[model samples]
Target: MNCWKTINISRDYGTLRLIMFSSSTVLLSFLFYYLVMSTIVQTTEFTQFGFVTVVLSLFGLVLTHKLLHCLPIWLFGGRAKIKISTRKLLFPLMDIKLREPLSRNVYLLALFSPLVFITTAGAVGSIMWPQFLPYFSILTSINFGLAFYDLVYASHLMKAPKQCYIEDHDEGFHILIKQAV
Candidate 1:
């Protein structure tokens, strides 16, 4: 069967949702960090360089996050081919594509595993040094934004029958439903 009509990433995630969610997440992150989490922050003699390092770690977290996301893909018996591709200009971006089709639960697990693991670590670190709450929250918020696409895809997958196959492609995913013989 032709899988062309199965999943269209562009149509699924259009420009409207992009502008709305991106702006909303940033605004909410600032508000939550200041209004809610600001109380938990403990004063410290954190140096500018220290803050600089913390900020720089966000970039490292991008790689770490991707790695964590791939753990399930590999453990669950899927192909995890890591590749580096350039964006609009010379900016490089790293991606890991899965060649195997994953079950609904497995796909969701891989999609959200990073969020749970990273957020928990951030929480522990925040407790050890509350002064880093702002950075942690901002980075966490950005991670959530990055995972938004997966969340939307998961929602789309929910429409499929219980016994369905989901393959991760460059544009998005192709959901194949298995029929009872």
Candidate 2:
């Protein structure tokens, strides 16, 4: 599959609308962090097993997050795939590709799904295992870090709605926005 595609942004309004739609993810992520982490530091602890668990959970979270973004593309009738660059272990990444163009809203949702899922799950895990809350809190931060790009693209994608993509070619995969019917 081709790793790059140019998104043609033909409308200014669509760009603005996309930006507005994508910014909500950042705002929501912040609100979630505040609501969930307010008292987390004071009440949590870490152990060897907890630390290991947190690391493993983070790996799972990252894979799941990537999968979440791909699901929307599939749901919209496009093919999505992940490819890793073995040469860049220092900055390993996943590349997403899709054939069918989806709506701006669908693309936005795909970007933010990981944040929503990982944060919610981390917060819930903390609550469930109060003694290991610190471990979970650390996992929460890691997941947030993973979502950073999705958040940024969500914003840029909003800005270039007509184009339907916010691609970082050094990375992989670009958002594809379909024309409105």
lDDT agreement with native, every candidate? 0.71, 0.64
Q: State each candidate's clash count.
A: 0, 6
Residue 38 of model 2: what lDDT? Answer: 51
Over 22-127, each residue of candidate 1 has an lDDT whose tens digit, in order, gives 7687577656754565567665644233767876787788888888888988888887877878878666698878877778777778878877887677667766
lDDT of 2: 0.64
lDDT of 1 at 171: 66
Candidate 2 Cα errors over 4 Å, as ranges: 1-54, 88-92, 162-181
